[model samples]
Target: MIETPGILLTILSFMLVIGPLVFVHEMGHYLAGRIFGIKADAFAIGFGREIAGFTDRRGTRWKFGWLPLGGYVKFAGDMTPASEPSAEWLALPAEERQRTFQSKPVWQRAIVVAAGPVVNFVVAIVILAGFALAYGDVRMPPVIGATVPGSAAALAGLQQGDRVTALGGRSVETFDDMARYARIRAGERTRIDVLRDGRLVSRDVVIGTELQRDRFGNEYRIGRLGIAGGKPIVVRVGLLEAPAVAVKRTGEIVSMMVETLGQVISGRRSVKELGGPLSIAKVSGEQMSLGLDAYVFLIALVSINLGFINLLPVPMLDGGHLLFYAIEAVRRKPVGPDVQEWAYRGGLAAILALMLLVTFNDLGNFGLWKNLAGLIG
Candidate 1:
């Protein structure tokens, strides 16, 4: 079990990571509204009771809330932070209604809602690009520098300076290709073909195992080939190209998330694999212990995940609002107020259920259930 201080570290790390991201997300919405001349009523970080805050000259209440889980922006015509239309605000005079959010065109309203997630994505892309430009990336040829003594590669007669051509029947063109192929088959038997003295040689061996878990649910077998990689060439990404590289990397992460979700839906993966804030807190602590770089990367990753989740067309989320806007655009009228009310209610129930399930899974991961059982007995 983690000690009390370690637990405190985790809580602090979670706040450090989450607080700024939430601010950026809400700021995105607030700024977008400003761009279209809509006035905001409040700009909040977190939820629930007020912590420390002040009202801005624009009549916007800027405050931090006790609960620090998420945040929102209340626009002029909103009934609540959820952006529900206000009956009283709707009854205001024509001049007073001019700057309200609901008075904006459907397209403008959609942009305001989407700005939150878009800002999250932009933050990730900028951070990743900065890293690539500053630290460079691994892009080298596939050559073995040395094999670990008494290990699988050595036992299989592999030698230093050997160029790997293929692993497990897959072609290996770069060092990254070899690493990617081998990292998934730990402890499994595999064939490796190498180029030595301009001749081809093949060997069969069991890929060594090292279990790696980045988060609560994301695990990798991380096959250890027992051979050191050749000297990695430093490929300093140019400023002009860094953004493209960042975009590609971001796309890959999104693809992985999509694939994982598909697997869960298809029953190839369990619903328990889904994690929540508790799991995030735990992993945030772990990454902080590694180094600032690792923790910063985690922040970027979580930002992207936040963007993707908000883009999902589930009711009560930003995407759900976008979905309603899309329908309004097509039909040339807003969704009926009663229908929206019922839909939001259903959405709230669904979100609550998901949160409960994920929290239960997180507690199980922490062995809380086992601890409770022990005490009960």
Candidate 2:
């Protein structure tokens, strides 16, 4: 069983990782609202009972809530759960409703809604750049450091110290590139070009396959090349190049997220592979055990995930709100409140169901459920 200290550490780690990400996301909305002359009634850091709060000079109540799950920005004249204003708001005196979100121009409203997710992306980019600049980028070159005995690479006469110059005629610059190529070509015959002992060599390699588990406890066959690469070597970059590195890193993260999501949706990956807060806590705790760099990298990766997920066009998410704004922009009118209300209700249900599913997977992955089942058995 995980100890008390371990559980507490996991909880604290979850808060640390999630709190700032949530804050940055909400701040994007708050700042954009203010910029568009919309009055924000409250800017909260969490949900549920307010633990502490103070009203700013601008009349925005800044508060820290007891529940650390999520937060929101309550706009002026928002009558229905602090989202876009309702028709009742429009019926109010012109001056009184002026600051209402729905009263703003469509473009401004879109900006305000889109800002939240955009801020998440921005935060991810900044964090990536900062880490890259401070620690220098460390990555493995496309060189084979080791090969498992009897593995495909070994069987194909591939040996340690062989640099993979190309795979299937595609130039491989990094180990990751080679891995991706191998994964995509799994179970297929492929030609490889290697530099061995300063001599160019060619070989036919068949990618191996193995079962992999996702965070959701779902398993799938993933292509594997039975070769390991050396540890990443730090590559320093100039100040001017830091931002470029950050952008590149962010793009790579986004691409990975897209691929993962596509695989999940296509049933190539299991739904059990999804993770929730529990899984994140576990990962954070594990990273804490590794050291400061590992912890920071984990946090950055989570931040990127948070940002990318919010950008997904699902109801009750930031991206969903942005989608509504897009429709409003094109139609020159807001979506009907009834339509929005129904959509929100459905979205909330779907999100809650997903949360429960992911939570179940997390418990199973952590052996909590299995232990309980064992006791029953």
Candidate 3:
């Protein structure tokens, strides 16, 4: 059970982590629109009823909303928060049309829509690079430091000081490579190549499976090798190489998320693994407790997730706008308004359903429902 003080810390930490990232995301859209001479009606930090606001000299209403979950920028002539064009947009006079989003060229519109995600990616890269320079890179190699007595490695005749060179005939670059393959291929006999005492040795080992609980209390069945890894080496990154390393790390994260989503879709992974806002809060709290470096890393990781999710080709998302622009470019015209409206409605519903599912999972992870029942008793 968490103390009251701990709960407060979690909420405060969540706000500090999420607020800046979200503001940065919206700032991208605002800056892009302003650059292209488009007028913004409002720049909001959250949805729902406005708590406090003021009109800028340029006539944009800057406000903070009560709900504090997500935010949007209302472009001039937008019908809704989704940026769908309304009768207000179409009814604009020739002179006023110059300041509206719809009046911009298709390429310019695409840039404005894509800017939010792009900014998120940029923020993530910058944070990661800065952290790498500050802390250096501590990475573990594929060397086996010790084996569990009478466990898989012991039964397979694997010894300490052995370096894993390949697994199941596939070249292993790091310990993570071997572990990733082992986790998915559990309960199967696998072939491994090890370099020991300047000699290459081949061995067959049965991957062991175990149930593990994450910090959020979510259970996962992961394959274990019955061997512990050696100490990680700290490699300092130069300023010139930091950005490239950051980019590579971002790409790796994207690839992992894509593969995990693919696995979930293909029934190889569970859907409950998807987290929601509550999970974010829990993780933010945990990372904050760990240290500044850990917290900053979480921010970067979440930023990448935010950017990647927005780039998915789904309606009511930035990627959806890009998709429409692509189609318009190909056909030399915009899609029908009725079709776009319906697509947006459907997309909104889909997003809401996904949110509900992940929130339910989060509740279960925290044992909220179970605790409530106990309290009732």
Candidate topping TM-score: 3
Error of 1 at 258 (Å): 1.0
Over the stretch 128-242, how does candidate 2's per-residue lDDT look in tens digits? 7888789888778999999988778999899889999998898888898888766644476788899999999999988898787644344566677799999878899768888
* Candidate 3 lDDT: 0.85
Q: List TM-scores for all candidates, in order.
A: 0.78, 0.82, 0.84
lDDT (C-alpha) at residue 241 in model 2? 84
- Which regions of candidate 3 are displaced past 4 Å? 1-5, 67-70, 80-86, 139-171, 180-207, 213-220, 227-231, 371-377
Task: Give all candidates' CA lDDT scores.
Answer: 0.86, 0.81, 0.85
> If candidate 2 were superposed on the true structure by all CA atoms, what would the RMSD be?
4.4
Q: Which of candidates 1 and 2 is the stronger one according to TM-score?
A: 2
Supply every candidate's count of residue pairs whose N, Cα or C atoms clash at under 3 angstroms: 0, 3, 0
Candidate 2 regions off by >4 Å? 1-5, 68-70, 81-87, 139-149, 154-173, 180-223, 228-233
* Candidate achieving higher lDDT, 2 or 3: 3
Per-residue lDDT value at 215 in model 1 = 38
Q: 1-377, model 1: which lDDT tens digit per residue?
A: 33232888999899888888988998999999999988899988898899899998888999889988668888889674345667797789988788899889999999999999999999999999999899886688989998988777999999999999998787888887776656545677889999999999999999887777653344554678888887788888999999987897788678668856875778756788788999899888888887899999999999999999999888889999999999999999988888888888888899999999999999988889999999999
